[model samples]
Target: MNAAPPLTPAQISFFHEEGYLIVPDVFAPADLEPLRQELHREIDRKARALKAEGRLENLHEELDFDRRLAAIYRDSKENGETIMRHLEGLRGGGFHAPEMFDVIASPKLLAKVGSLLGTGEIVASSVYRIRPKLPNIGRGVVPWHQDSGYFSTHCDKQLIITCWAPLVDATVENGCMQILPRTHRGEVAMHHTGGNAGFLVIKDENLPDDPRKAVTAACPRGGVVFMTNRTPHCSTPNYSDHIRWSMDLRYQSAEAPNNVGLWPESLDAAGKADDAFYEKGNVACYPPEADFLVQSRLHPEQVTNYAEYVRRRETYDRTQANFSAFRRWPESVATK
Candidate 1:
């Protein structure tokens, strides 16, 4: 196999200093077309179902991919409902469309990840998100919060990398991500659940005194913005007429403790065998779905396919009896 692309010294330095990095032209049109096609297929199915149920009169088939969902919700009686309601359900904190597997497991993406991680053994995190920032929708406006705020405290020391890729050109008017420089150097800030969609957000009192330091990451199609788990970032509202389509995929070093790639094997290490762990108010990393191997130097043959991905997710849903309802930090931690 070909060697993964390596990050230049300058690029690596910038990432460490700013807590985020933007790599342009890492992907081509071909790399994104497959994922777009898959999205269209799923949207078409949803439209058909809605029409059959009399929730929609026309399928709005003439509308482009960016306008279809907005038009559907506008034309339907479900005017109060958001476009996200019609999209795929969140699996392991994100959308799990089978068609997205190709992009999720793309070698090119893994190459970039390997460069930053300095290891070929990379594990894809289960916490990936497909964000469709609809026009004039408040739900698309994410509030300031570090990615670490959503994860278990057990993984605090591990490095989790988030790659936010936009299918279309992302601009300030279309809800592109913005980040606070060097915020990763600090501890996770006090966050509360109170955004456009009840998303976790750092309280305003905890925001940096210098608000002008935040930088907007206006990326083009096929470009990606990589941020550390502790990076403080959020997106503005989508004021444009079209949907701002984007996906946030995460990766971590395979050797990291609580590595989701190890799945059933990591379960023991994550304290699945210890009932006392749960009783003591500790939660496992992503207790909802089964994570799978994406790229492994030691066991390349074991990389998960679409079929296995589905099987494992299904098995997790069926066999895992209860998911932890605890999603917030205690007052002591949040106040600190």
Candidate 2:
């Protein structure tokens, strides 16, 4: 794939001033199917594991595909560790999966991100999430909160940008993501634990409305919605019969500090020079004993992939300078 087209002056201004910008057709529809297939496979695997562990009685009958998977696990202290460990694996802390790079370093998508940051050297650090709307369950309303509410970074500006992409036709009826227009320009809200599920938190107030209603991001599959880390957004609970799946990616500057203490092996063995933060923050959220197997399963290649993705992106910058037009659309459109 070719590097993405540079952002228009208007798009850049919108992103900086408003804290978000949406680009249409960042990737061809065809590029989305492989991801869709993988998502299904991963969810299926999770289902099987949950069933085996007696977390669920049956995958087909009891698994609520509409509920956000992030909130479905048991509300135990270990639950937080389980989620973090899984994220560490998927977001360049686990196996060397190309899909991780695809989402983080996608040539087309990164250009838009680069345009917003005003830099070509982009560092992507994001979570992979799935919203499985099960039948008959409330698509819990996600309280208003900025993505940075959970991040450890301390910058005057927002360091997190969320790329939300859905695998199905997202609609108001099916619990699509909702955003409050222009609210990100205000003060960053204080967050506390929310009522949605285990450990999920949101701001204390509902968004104010006057002339406008909450904008529902209901779009066809393969379309992407870009929002600021500070944007107050949430989704209705899915009562739909089908599963509504989507992924959220995080990106930052290569120079930014990352709390990657979770990846112990990624640190250098040599006399801990210049890198002491990883070990300091890498404390396990789970109990001491539960960490043995989980940490062992973590592969160091994930850290390498993230570093390399940044390097390869520079090669793409040169190519971007030469190319001026977009590439052919992907094949998913034919099916649509």
Candidate 3:
């Protein structure tokens, strides 16, 4: 792996000013190849298993990684969903592999992250997502909202950075993110439930800035688009012929409130954990997921390894914590 480079002073300045920064060379293109190949292999394994079980008609073996799931979906939504659920597009779903963990804990990626955050003691939120935006799919279309909209109100005042990296080149034609620049410094926009894909959305009138000023964020395979937690952004549909595969990871300063080192004494399939743990978990920005120390110069021994990360994630997956810290949005009442 190549050594991670730090962002220049000007680059950091632009990110703070514009609310989003697309750095196109944070990782060497080769650095992403391992994860991509592993994901493709995992898809093949899942598809074969489905076929053996008679859940799918075609394996879609001829198609490449970008088009395989789309082909499966074209044949059977059930089969596609099964494979997607295994790969996990949502938070705390499945898809835990060494390749995925390596990307998240990559020293190269962390250096750039540390530079933007202005701190070495970084807490990586388990809020990361594996997004596979398929061609012409309306379900992949994310509505306008800030990352903070999903977090507790107590965390809105803190700085949590989101790092979005595409597995393939993200283009406007392929549903790359659209960010509203210079609009992240204010209060979190009012978000409503029932946006496409069950995501929260900021209504036009509720947006912090005019939608016309939003910039199309096109990033390459090795690049990362860094945005603040309050940066208002949305994704468009993929009109292109391939999938727009990307991962959106989150990180924050260690001084900020987090649920690091917090685990349930016991958790069950019913989504229940220790009663006291529920209370303490509420201190995390997103209480449902487990946060871990990704980088800590103060205590390098405490950095979570792959085994521990997987255990923490899987353990947290079985838990559904009750949260009262974040303000809940009402269901969408719009007819249009």
Best by TM-score: 3
What TM-score does structure 1 among the candidates reach? Answer: 0.86
Deviation of model 3 at 137, angstroms: 1.1
TM-score for candidate 3, residues paired by index: 0.93
Q: Give the alpha-carbon lDDT of every model.
A: 0.74, 0.51, 0.86
**For this target, which candidate reaches the highest lDDT against the unseen true structure?**
3
lDDT of 1 by residue, 1-336 (tens): 776466788888898888899998778968898788778777777678766777767778898777887787667636314336534336332345666878888888888888888888877776677778888878778888888888766766678899999988999999999898887877777777655576787765787535468899999989999999888898999999998999898888876643243334334533254564455543435656566678888998977788877666655543443644335754322321
Cα displacement (Å) at residue 145, model 1? 0.4
lDDT of 3 by residue, 228-319 (tens): 99999999999999999998999998877787766755545544456676666447888677788999999999999989888888867656
TM per model?
0.86, 0.64, 0.93
Output the better candidate (1/3) by TM-score: 3
lDDT of 3: 0.86
lDDT score for residue 60 of model 1: 81
Alpha-carbon RMSD of each model: 4.3, 13.3, 2.5
Across 1-336, the per-residue lDDT of candidate 2 in tens digits comes to 654687899877777665566565677778876665565455556656766887654345344433334334433324324433453342223322456456555767777777676665554553435444443444334545566555433432545567877767777777788777676766555555434553234533433332145577776676677787777677776666665666676665544443233232332343121335543443211101001110111342343354454343333223222222211212221110
Candidate 1 clashes between residue pairs 3 or more apart in a chain or in different chains: none
Q: lDDT of model 1 at residue 46? A: 68
